[model samples]
Target: MAESSTARVIRLRPVDDVAIAAVDVAAGTGVDAGGGVVVARDDVPRGHKIALRALRAGAPVLRYGQVIGFAGRDIAEGEHVHLHNLEYREFRRDYEFGVDARITEVLAEADRDTFAGYVRSDGRVGTRNYLGVLTTVNCSATAAKQIAARLRHSGVLDEFENVDGVVALTHGTGCGMAPDGEGAAVLRRVMRGYLTHPNFAGFVVLGLGCEDNQIAALTRDVHMRPEVPVFTSTIQELGGTRKTVAAGVARLTEMLPIANAARRSRVPASALVLGTNCGGSDSYSGLTANPALGNAVDRLVRQGGTGIVGETPEIYGTEHMLVRRAVSERVGRKLLERIDWWREYTAKNGGSMDNNPSPGNKAGGLTTILEKSLGAVAKGGTTALTDVVEYAEPVTTPGFVFMDTPGYDPVSVTGIVAGGATVVCFTTGRGSAFGCAPVPSIKIATNTPLYQHMTDDMDINAGGIVDGDTTVEQVGERIYRRVLAVASGEPTRSESLDYGEEEFVPWHLGTVM
Candidate 1:
């Protein structure tokens, strides 16, 4: 399939049962949709959908050859297909393993090619250069922010355009929490991931000095390198808050020029680590954006690249599909273990995995976790399950892999970035304005109108599926192309809007006393 711009009407698949026009057309315009459909109606807009075949009430509307939803009412050929005319049905999916699966053929020496990334002292590749300011507890958050704020006033960035920014990573749950429970363990994993993240050019650790999470323990557990220009200051050690902040700023200023020298150069696609996630999701998310992303995931794996899919609770019930594709029993076991962990974790916390599908999801037509999982799994595509790892563990395999993480958007993406994802692709319905620090994020809109309404944040639109204007494979290919463009330095919508600055939220575990 070839790529086309969003300037005209385009039909994606012959079996698509629909044709989507690029621009909106009015009714009774004698529309020639190329498949024996006359202009039965007018007024189709760009990115809107039109039917290719006649659909009856309760009949399934197929895209990507999967039932995305059913026709809510009878429709004629060449008519528009969207939310008003369709409703999600109760779907029971049978696993047809490898029915459409193909193994990723790794070419000789392809695995050895690398991107011109900042090879961290710890052996991870970073796609961005950033100087991070770490706070040991919420008590020091204002101080950490003050330190970062001082950099702007000091003309430090004037000499460091190559450096992303000086971000202060602070959270709400660092002290008074259980020191050795699930909360502590998750917090440690998240914190360690940030300290060792390749995107950081240099960092400074700050604290009130006497909080339960000692700066000393964080430094030890996070494994700050002896040579990475890490400076530490506690209010106690530095005599006061103002003094501590001053010390941190001074150390970061010294590291600025060193970070600024890092530059972007041609990097092989395999060096790309892609993070896959979906938020504010609706029924069309699994149908359009998710599968489209799956196609990009397949292409990246074929190019010897790596892609990571998180959101453990969201994948419940559909995990068996991945297990059947697992390359080793160990990998399968690891995945199952995470699922088991989530089950126990949620049970202890007085919830269930089925307690998902926010009010938005239910209103938008998704009924149950079973329904959502069948669609969510489409994000992984048809690749063999390469490996499974815990939160923030390094991703070394070159194909599709899963990371265990909370279903929360920020936390899940945090693990992906920590595990070394250089970029992220997020799919959303009902619009999302999320951004991430260190790694770049590209947002794909699940429906067309949402893309138009929130153009400031959306990078791609997968609504063509619902509009009957494009095929899933065609949209998938479009996403793949955008990935290459973003990797090659094209600024995504989030980047253009400077959304990265406020998005560096780390997961907080444990509870305040």
Candidate 2:
């Protein structure tokens, strides 16, 4: 409601034919139409689009100075521009490598910003020193969680102020499928990621002993040596769930001192690994919060920090935009290759890439996957995309990196965090309640209403941009600072609510049979 004096309709670009409604407009109500006024032809809801001028059938519908869709039928002035009149179309977008890539000015080593973090033996800097309880199969989830519960309920961590908390990461699949198939490979990658995550001071991997996801195999393969602070056992081998839980408790009790021994030290921002994501997005996501997050990404990247973004399907239409920013043609090609993989993956799964833009997205004014994607990638900021990584793969390259994962928020975030994101920033137009353990998630609300209604869940309000109170860059700076603070041990709302233990969802790549 802040962008314009009228506050009723907003035309983002001079060439745009559609203006977004800041509030619900009644049918026949006069709305400011640039230099003049036009009456609404039909009732237009808030955050929805309204045609600024008459449009013929198949005419390109423009928003944000780019074509979002085509008019499905003749559209009159001041009419709603949505699924009723708009249509999605497949079009080829040009991919030019390194065309928009900008090399960041690396801060002088002595001038680099810093955060208080737990510097690990492997040289990774962790924002939180958490002892993790990781499950290798659905059957072991309960036991793993019980172990974490015992630790928490016993007030065992009160003495370990440096140890953030105990988090048990449980998932639905690990068995009941071919052990060497694509599904197993994907599961292994997720397991490896969590086991090797920097946040965990130490981790206990629980298994059923017979599941395809063997903890033994995971450690040996992902390059973890036996002396590492990873403890693994199985329900069957330990006699039963109770015995297994007891064993876990004993091992972790001993590990408490070792894990708690980790202390925070000042580390450069180069030690920072950031994960950027958007969920419950609307038309304003690209216009405000996401771009603001992008600004923050640029700031961090310049400090030699890593910014990881994923949710492959969400990047579908905007792939070209990122391709242009790739540091190398090879890096650009890696992104395209992932896109191709998604296409085939979806087809085999009996779906389409266009099947994205969930019902909530459409209700929030996103029309197609293309439209949603163009908004989603705004979180990446304007930095050279230095790397493209597989789902759950460890990220070695700094700067902005793309990870391949499904568009689902929780699943996507898992891969990002698994890939070594030390902190996370999520933007949402509608409200979302999500958090990542070890890595704190700073939630940004895109509009004033959601910000006001969901104050408890939201940390930053980019709603100021919509209300005309602040610029995106101003809010972006706020986010950048907040991220550093959170990394330095400030608690996020979701973290305060204890919300991350249930969200460890790994991407399942193949069928059960």
Candidate 3:
């Protein structure tokens, strides 16, 4: 639907019965709805939707050309349509496997884009060369941080021009969870993922000797790579935290020169794996940033790059769209399996999937998780779903793939990063400053105000598309180019603000002991 030069309402699609309020519409505000003029019956917040026509109770409410929900009561034209009059309901979705799957038009290698990156000894291309300090247990978290702090405060990183920085990849689990169950396996998978990640030139995994996740066990179970140096130690064996920190510092000191020796060289865009998620989302998220990101994702996939779309819960109601694009029925069924798992998991915990859309989401024009999910899936782009991977598993497929993860921003991004995402692209409408280190994060804002308010943390403004200042493809191109720049060592806004430290939250499965 072509919006007028000064229109205050956005009809996302021609057939849609609702128009998103481009600006706050006070009661009695009049607007053109294409067929005729409509007047606001109540105050409607910007980003919220205004019904374009009358609806009887239980009638379907549509947005983005899909059913968002059913009207809980009679909805009058020009009235605010939100939590008060809309309600969530479950219905079967037709997931036609491989119905939309298509072979991507791959750009020729010589004509494809390239980015400057560190070429690891094992032939893996790296975006950033940082020395990592991983901890197996919460008890070792401080020691791990201290190790990195020792290098930071000492200023040794200044000499290592090629090295990005020393990062303490510490966490809060590994001691009380089931030592041999799925919980323990998940932690080990995450640890190994970070250890084998191409971004880290070298790393050390430290642990509390008495904890279930011991340093010795990690080394013994892990298949160490010759090209990547991995060292290990224990607080109990190293005497104490002070001694362990000293030992960690000494070990990393010995590796600084080697880390610094690494150099960036031209690499194909295929080497990059992008992880995308939307949090602090609002109604405009789907209409703006998320769709813009989806366009970028399609661009990356066409260029032979990998793009991961995760956050299983966030994709709940809209999953049939992805399942339809699956490369095979096996892949499609795998996605359904995870959806069932979440339903069961939530039920077991005495909760419902609709429990989300936290108060902030409601104020931002989202009513139910189903509505939020339908919008969130827009980040995946219209690429074939080549594969579906479990949480923390390696993503070996090249084009677009799906990784199962919770909707929690940090946890979902963590699993995606662990699955070999070297860079993260996060979209937000209400605003988010989240970042994933080792992997640089590029933030895309869904609204103009959010971008303006969080300019220091936002890297790109997709809101311009909403303001009709730019088109979706235009912002999408910027996002795709920004991903390459970040991979080539450009610092994103969140990286500049040092926001990746406390965001390293691994998914905790099962109950604590």
Top candidate, metric TM-score = 3
Q: After superposition, how far is residue 456 of candidate 1 from its true place, in Å?
A: 0.9
Clashes of 3: 0
- Between candidates 2 and 3, name the one with more favorable TM-score: 3
TM-score of each: 0.79, 0.96, 0.98
C-alpha lDDT (0 to 100) for residue 456 of candidate 3? 92
Query: How many clashes in each structure?
Result: 23, 3, 0
List the global CA lDDT of all models: 0.74, 0.86, 0.87
Worst 10-residue lDDT window for candidate 3 reads: 1-10
Worst 10 residues of 2 by lDDT: 1-10
For 222-330, candidate 3 gives per-residue lDDT tens digits of 6555766777878998999899999999989888888888888998898889999999999899888998999999999989999999999888888888889999999
Stretches of model 2 off by over 4 angstroms after superposition: 1-7, 33-36, 225-228
What is the lDDT, from 0 to 100, of the residue 48 in candidate 2?
A: 88
